[model samples]
Target: MVKRQAQHIQVDLQRQQLRLLSGDACIASYAISSARNGAGESRGSECTPRGLHSIRLKIGDGLPENSVFIGRRPTGEIYTPALAAADPGRDWILTRILWLSGLEPGRNRGGSVDSLRRFIYIHGTPDSEPMGQAASHGCIRMRNRELIELFERVRVGTVVEIRERC
Candidate 1:
């Protein structure tokens, strides 16, 4: 069993990178894509809510790559160029998903800006989405291979900090 610990996951939107940290030491860092509309704390705004949060639930462990999902349930079919072409407009959320919940109650937890209620996740995406660029509805999207590796390193209740570039 993976013991849950309070680790830090820092996202630098300006740098388009996600850094995993244990205390003051850096564990791993990878390129990431945040909300294209920029970051904020608002519901139905399709913007990435910024501030302190934690991994509420981690989903799709041991699942096959490219496995289609809607509402977090497997659709039992792997993603392909053909399937992608069929639905070019579809935003592919694949592989693993780290569902996030905001720590701040009034800021990002309850009400419209609730991160959990918004289904915000750090999930795998098709390679088509460029790394180091803002291009997601609200969640942070990472490449499948990178996400799988990341998923193995973290656990539920991991701390995630998102702040505007200073």
Candidate 2:
């Protein structure tokens, strides 16, 4: 019999990568899109907040890939190229979401620095969106299929550390 170490997530803002690690080994690595504004903790900064966080909620289980979400709820709309063309400026949140809450107070948590209040999430982006670079408004974005796979592996309350490097 084998015992598997519990998995945790790490987001490297500088590399624009996200790694799923179990113990000292990396179980999976994926290209990610972080924030265009870089790293910060203030509300409306549109920057990725850096600190210890956890998956406060896991959303979109059983939902189809490319399923659209707004305010953390399914919008009954599946993303399509035509749909994207119709509203090109829309901030797309698709497939799955891992809502994050900061563990460190006065940094990523509480008041203006509250990541949860900022609606920081690890969610899916359109296939047309480029990864491996910082482009998100604030959240961590991944490919739809990749996000779904990650969502299946991680549970609510999984530790997720976001930093300049993993």
How does residue 9 of candidate 1 score in lDDT? Answer: 90
Q: Which stretches of candidate 2 lie over 4 Å from their true place?
A: 1-5
Per-residue CA lDDT of candidate 2, range 1-166, in tens?
A: 2233377888899889999999878999999999999999999999999988989999999999999998999999999999999998887999999999998999998999999999999999999999998998999999999999999999888888888976
lDDT of 1 by residue, 1-166 (tens): 2332447798988888998988777889899999999998788888888888999899999999877788988888888889999999887899989999999888789998899999899999888889899999989999999999999999898988887671
Best candidate (score: TM-score): 2
Query: Could you tell me how far off, in angstroms, the CA of residue 61 lies in candidate 1 after the best superposition?
Result: 0.6
TM-scores, all candidates, are 0.94, 0.95
